[model samples]
Target: MMTFRDKTVVFNAPKVMGILNVTPDSFSDGGQFNKLDDALKQTEKMIASGATFIDIGGESTRPGATPVTLEEELDRVIPVIDAITERFDTIVSIDTSKSEVMLEAANHGASLINDVRALSQPGALETASRLAQEHNIPTCIMHMQGTPETMQDLPRYNSVVDEVIEFFRAQIERLTANGFEYKQIMLDPGFGFGKTLDHNYEILKRFDEFTQFDLPVLAGMSRKSMIGNLLNKGITERLAGDICVNTVASLAGASILRVHDVGEAADVSKIIEKLNQINV
Candidate 1:
């Protein structure tokens, strides 16, 4: 169980985290929820669809994506976060790597800090450490081979699974050394962040390996290029593939499913829950 603010998410069953990208170029569903009204509507839809967490990202981390300024990222996400906290009762995750952005979003009512850069940015670790100490806020540290701008430029790994596990092992040690408790940290293998088609599949096939830390593992393969590239499907046509991969992740012990289609992902969780309850 992970407690944030006044809420506790019991991971006895897998939970769904809806992706709400408040950016103009997030590769998929970018501009759809950048506006205040649209973001609220989508939040309502996702909550009603059974999303336990709504992940709001200001900057686009797509391959070859350009970086947004601190001011622009803050401006894009803070207002939406404020409105969502005021209106909804769901946990809000701030998907950013900026220190100032993490502080502002937490002040405005974000409970989870989902940093793809794994809080490696200059001041991000310090800021997040403070937040964790004060609010007991949890952070999800993902494994990315390189920066978003150049991660896909011929990505390579000596042993993807071992490297990711080592990365988590090192990161958890660093975060705990910096004052974060074991329960306050989560892990994401970072599908499609810096991996090729083969690398992504290898991680998926070995998804259960990440559970070694006993921390919650988040599988965020929703509408990612891994699915698109593998199945020869376009962005909008990858839902079936997304569901399949997420199902595999769930059975492999993923505690959280970060996805674009909340309703479908929720359904997947339900079926998996039922399966887990069956007698062998």
Candidate 2:
């Protein structure tokens, strides 16, 4: 069970983390929920559909995307987070790499920190450690080869899975060194962050290798390029492919599936749990 604030999330099946991107340039669903009302409505729908967590992101971390200022990011996410917390009984995961945003979101009631950069940005580690201890929340540290802008340009890996595990090891050590318990950290292999089509699939095929750390594994393959470029399907049309990936990841021991569609992901979780129950 993962405890955050007053909420304790115990996942019998893979928990579906509904994606609520309040940005103008995310690869999928960008500019769709930038409004507070729309964001709340979406949050309501996802929670009603059985989302255990709501991942709210203010900045667009899409490859080649321009960066937003700290003020701009805060302006985009704080109000929506406040509204969601006021109205819903869901855990909000702040998807950011900025230390100030992390501190402010924690203050405003965010329950988890999900950073693509793994809290390596300037003061992020310090802030994250303090917040984890103060709020008693867990964090998701994702592995990326480089910055979003240049990550896809010339992505290479001696062994993608091994390198990612090593990255998680170093990150976990750093977080523990800064006073965070090992249980307070999770791992995300970052499907499309800096991987080619083959590299992404290789990681997915070897997803269980990460389970050796005994930490919850998060898979965020919803509508990523690995599916699109392989199947030639656009972002909105990748739901079928996304569901397939979610299923495989869950079967591979992913504890959390961060996805764009909560309803379908919930269905997948239920079915996978049922299938896993048979002791034949």
Candidate 3:
């Protein structure tokens, strides 16, 4: 199984994965951390805020997010990976499903492969499975209905919860048949990729259904279209909405909250976990 020095296993329990999108076109934090020096500073700050994992995304997977080739993706991410691995003693997750990117990241020092495509990119999943076995890296499998270019056109689901559960079951079977251990896997419901506002809310309301598999749930609703589109707000004006979404997600049993604002969300999680301990 994948392990960290601080006993922060990615798949076993709830953990905070702070987002560090080192790309120019990321939905929210693009161009913010693409600089090597800026990325290094942001990563260190995130670690100080109780983040267990640093999820670095070289490509923007936001709905209708433009695509980037493997070369561009690597050029954008490798330096950051090199810089972070050189400095931190924390687990760093590379958020990409491309096999080439995956292999390069494995070589560079990534411990988790958070794939939004769920590795459907022709041998991508299989490659990730093998890499996990080879490098002891855990993988987070997420469900997206369509390509990021067109996922928001007419996203539909008769019963999102059931369909997502089915997807997870099938994905798990695929990985298992490929010789992957269950302990090295995590699950993400992929809240805004191809869902309507209602579908997103439904997934959040029934988040516990995913916990049935006993896998850690990673939620990424921070500053997403689900919050601003629902509230008719802009990306720069969604802090309260983002915080509220994180609060609901944490309460709904999400093991990891992937957020853009690390320090604020870290404080919120601290207070909430404290109250939960009191109740326990």
Q: For residues 1-280, write the lDDT of model 1, one tens digit per residue.
A: 8888778988877899999999988899989999999999999999999999999999999999999999999999999999999999999999999999999999999999999999999999999999999998999999998899999999999999999999999999999999998899999999998999999999999999999999999999999888898789999999999899999999999999999999999999999989988999
Q: For candidate 3, write residues 111-144 as lDDT tens digits.
A: 8889999988877877888886776777889999
CA shift at 261, candidate 1, in angstroms? 0.5
Per-residue error for 149 in candidate 3, Å, reads 0.7
Score every model by TM-score: 0.99, 0.98, 0.94
Model 2, 16-101: lDDT tens per residue? Answer: 99999999888899999999989999999999998999999999999997789999999999999899999988899999999999
Looking at candidate 2, what is the lDDT of residue 45? 95
**How many pairs of residues collide in model 3?**
1
Q: Could you arrange the candidates by TM-score from highest to lowest?
A: 1, 2, 3
Please state the error at residue 77 of candidate 3 in Å: 0.6
RMSD list, candidates in order: 0.8, 0.8, 2.0
**Model 2 regions more than 4 Å off:** none
- Per-residue error for 254 in candidate 2, Å, reads 0.4
What global local distance difference test value does model 1 have?
0.95
